[model samples]
Target: MSETNDTGTAAPAPVSNWNVPNALTTLRIVMVPFYGWALLVDGGDSVAWRCVAWFIFGVAMITDKVDGDIARKRNLITNFGKIADPIADKAITGMAFIGLAIIIDTWWMWAITVVVLVREWTVTLLRLSILKRVVVPAAQSGKVKTAAQAVGLGLLTLPLLEVDGWLDVPGEVVYGFALVILGIAVVLTITSGYEFFREVWRQRHEIREKSPERRK
Candidate 1:
């Protein structure tokens, strides 16, 4: 699901301040390829590729912030963004985590990666199903999940931050810390996903009760 701008106006001009949010989204989309290249084609573990991947990851993270700010400040939040933004985020984070899991040879990393991806994928369908009955707004827990995922992903990418002639932390500590935090993040991610689904169900039931068609 991609993040959408909620500019409520029905007939927004083709070019508006809203462009900032879309531009940032586009930037993130563009970075995915470069990030993939840095990891797969360029020898992700090497210093040169590490810098490229790190930069791409950093920029992707930054755009997550930038797009939100632009949407809220400009009142350009749209349903499209609400849907696409999260999808875009999942795609990028999923790639990074999966790549690291493969490279590091950690089975737990893959497990966490799968858990996170499942949460993301599940919520989209869950929300869509509930949207038929009631409007489902983003919840606080959902936001927290996104933040946690970002932190976990950033930490996981530390190995890719390696640079020649630069100090590298001991592998044990880095992976250990990342694993712990990612585990916590996965817990939160799943919990939030469940909560979101519960909220949707409750709202949908409420809507049904109020609808006259239900009386028949």
Candidate 2:
């Protein structure tokens, strides 16, 4: 993990997984089960529990952003962070999708959850598997997808439209907005996934074509 500095002297210190950023990532992963439990309490009907779940989801999302920023800023990136960070992100959102599908019991919810999760995890696993071999940069579609997914899922994780009270009309409006954003996120997921695989294949193929043996 150590890398040589200028002049080909001794190597710089290796970045450790035991750092603040990775700690936050680990904390986010640990929050996933609690968030799910709170979300599912009373079949996702309890206002207090849903609020708790939303708070936890928000914290997890914030930590996701923070951990990446801190890691890059402090040069604390590690294999653990590379693997666990994505897993943590997917776990929270994946649980959100699954939990919402169960509570809503809508055909579309179930369908989108299946499609999106399959695409997400497949792309994630592929990226991780080729981390050191093929370098596929993040696409704009992927960034948009993450933001839309986070906002949509965060809004939906609340008891907004599902609970009846003073917030009913506004809640419905927000819920509708969330659905629209979630729909866009789903489309972006598929498109970005395709772009990712295509780029990975292109990079690997180019590497092979330029190799000494292949040239010979």
- Predicted candidate 1 versus true structure: per-residue lDDT over 1-216, tens digit per residue: 333457744554443435678778877877787786676544456656755676788889899898989798978877667666766777788788777767666777678778877878777766555476566687787777777777766766655245323345465466567677677778888888887778878987888898899988
Give lDDT tens digits, candidate 2, residues 1-216.
Answer: 557779887786877778999999999999999999999998999999999999999999999999999999988999999999999999999999999999999999999999999998988898788557888888999999999999999999999867777889999999999999999999999899989889988988899999999988
Taken over the whole model, the C-alpha lDDT of each candidate is 0.72, 0.92
TM-score of each: 0.80, 0.94
Error of 2 at 16 (Å): 2.0
RMSD of each: 5.8, 2.1
Name the lDDT value of residue 13 in candidate 2. 82
Q: In terms of TM-score, how similar is model 1 to the real structure? A: 0.80
lDDT at position 3, candidate 2: 70
lDDT of model 1 at position 118: 81
Q: Which stretches of candidate 2 lie over 4 Å from their true place?
A: 1-8
